[model samples]
Target: MTATTPTPTPTPTSPSAPHHQPLLRPMDLAGLRLPNRVVMAPLTRARAARDGLVPTPMHADYYGRRASAGLIITEATWVSRQAIGFADVPGIYSAEQVTAWRRVTDTVHALGGRIVMQLWHTGAASHPDHLGGRVPAGPSPVNPRTRSFTTTGFQETVTPRAMTPAEIAATVADYRAAAHNARQAGFDGVEIAALGTFLIAQFLNPRLNHRTDAYGGDRTRRRRLLLEIVDAVAEPWDGRCVGVRLGPYLAAGDLFRPDAATLADHDELVTALNDHPVAYLHLRGPDRPTPDARPDTAALARYRHRFHGPLNANNGFDRETANAAIEAGTADAVSFATHFIANPDLVTRFALSRDLATGDPTTYYGGGARGYVDHPVSTWQDNPGQQP
Candidate 1:
């Protein structure tokens, strides 16, 4: 059987009503049961402890507070030290991170919410300022044209040291270990960070990955690391425990790359991942919900061609556009980021066509519960005259 139901239409909103159960239909992946298709894309807010390695109680509360989503994906948690691209970013390679994440997973589970941790590596996108002035590493030595998200503000992106063959092998091991930690953390599963123009993305894009070695020259070689990581991480993970997010030519940060030559390589990738034990492919398209942004349509369709798993479509998808994509058979599910970040009861709001709570950028990156959990549920008090 397929991952999602054979429904003819995506969930629709009743204009006259305030709210209803969001597209609540069940789907199965691996062994985990997804009560609904709405997923929380992994958002990178530096709320972790100072070391950028530990999961604090607030992190648990932060996730637990938004337990109403169909599925919750944790922030881009690193799998190894070399993969640590940002300060205060969490990692799963450490025993302590595993222990700390356990608290978060337990809390979310207590709320009857399902969550997944995204395994990440920043690559050339990392700044020296963020990592003890250490040059970040990537598939090549090329520097990124983007800036880093610093504690106070944005800092310039710097050229990173390229990885040796030995380092690449070790990096693969780190991902395998992180998968083990994710299971120990009590998460429903883990998703590999192949999106948002991170380390893996850096390698996959020819524009950034200017190398003649087996790891770069062509799309076949570029996909080596990504494919290997998928196989490695799935080795020990249980439940419906694996997903991958791919931005393709996403224009976020310094992660932009065009799809002119990488198209066929992408097809091979999707075909390969589909044959694996993976559960879903999280994809991005043009329009980041914010204006003046261009979407990556070629990358969006790449996943659909060969991937048979549940497709969680993201990027600039409003309620209307999201449903349209689903109804049109473009994506099996849709992950809402900024909207999910602000609205704890997003599913409720979407169900009724109610006005979503305005997301505050002030507290978006790193802050306490101000914009995180302070948003009220869609009850009559907050949005009166609306059905609960």
Candidate 2:
């Protein structure tokens, strides 16, 4: 997530015109120099091995093809079985998972693309069937508004049992180990999935957390878990290798944070991270039919004063909009979620101002490489191998 003020300034479509480089060119976030500003936002593709949550060789091929972007953050990786909210999502807790992910990271690097794993825990959204018959955990028992994917079938999210103090400490440890496994998997870094409806976000949301402990109540205490996780992940790892993603305003995942509290935590977290050494802050506003979900950067005008680090703002950003954001200095870079799903060589296509392939929603998730790895880069018809 990028450091933002209340108002996010838009960048020029082409800061350096004539040559027609990408709307946002390659940039250095902390110490990571990306070839372009369009980050491959982590999308859930449940292709991991059925039993152990291990990544397969196909995962390597899948990510290696899209190495043209500034960075590729892999899909949500569950920190523990209790965190297994999504079917077939990868994991970093087991040695087998680490080994399998190593292939993915090596493949991406061999192809000249850097990758990061998005560490995640589903909290109350997790299903009992998915976690050794255990009930899901959250601030309270508030279930997700929508159905969550389970191993057996889609189930209604249940009110989860509140966790004990020891449980919270254990989760923090889970994050630490996941970070360690991420390093062992040879990843460039890890992104904290504090965004959306993950466990950490649940602990921070007052509407959901309704707890009386230090982890609940006010916005400042609510954010304690996320901040600690960030700091925990950064403890033994390089500061530049840790990134965090969250949606301050729009409710994605299972969380719908209040507008004012969203703004407050945004400032607090950024300020707290000012002294720490994290790579980037990945901020997502609402996307799709609704644009402009990013929080009021103007409210956080002081975040710039406190945190002077890399910011990657994500939403429904196109080439033109992304460049505008960069030029305005609202964000150091922009992230593309759907755009990259269809355009394998999105950077080149954007640089040349070529036509982009429309992404197939059906193939976005639950499918094999059919829609995952086979998307065309340029003219769909030009690539003989892309035909479904």
Tens-digit lDDT track of model 2 for 48-75: 8887888888898889988877899988
Off by over 4 Å in 1: 1-22, 238-240, 253-255, 288-302
Candidate 2 residues lying further than 4 Å off, grouped into runs, are 1-24, 252-257, 288-306, 379-388
TM-score (C-alpha) between model 2 and the true structure = 0.87
> lDDT score, residue 282, model 1?
85
Clashes of each: 5, 23
Model 1 C-alpha lDDT versus the unseen true structure: 0.76
Candidate RMSDs in Å, in order, are 6.7, 7.9
Q: Give the alpha carbon lDDT tens digit for every residue of 59-126 in model 1.
A: 88889977877799998898877676666778888888889999999999999899988898877887
In angstroms, the error of model 2 at 320 is: 0.6
TM-score of each: 0.88, 0.87
Q: Model 2 clash tally?
A: 23
Q: Looking at candidate 1, what is the lDDT of residue 33?
A: 79
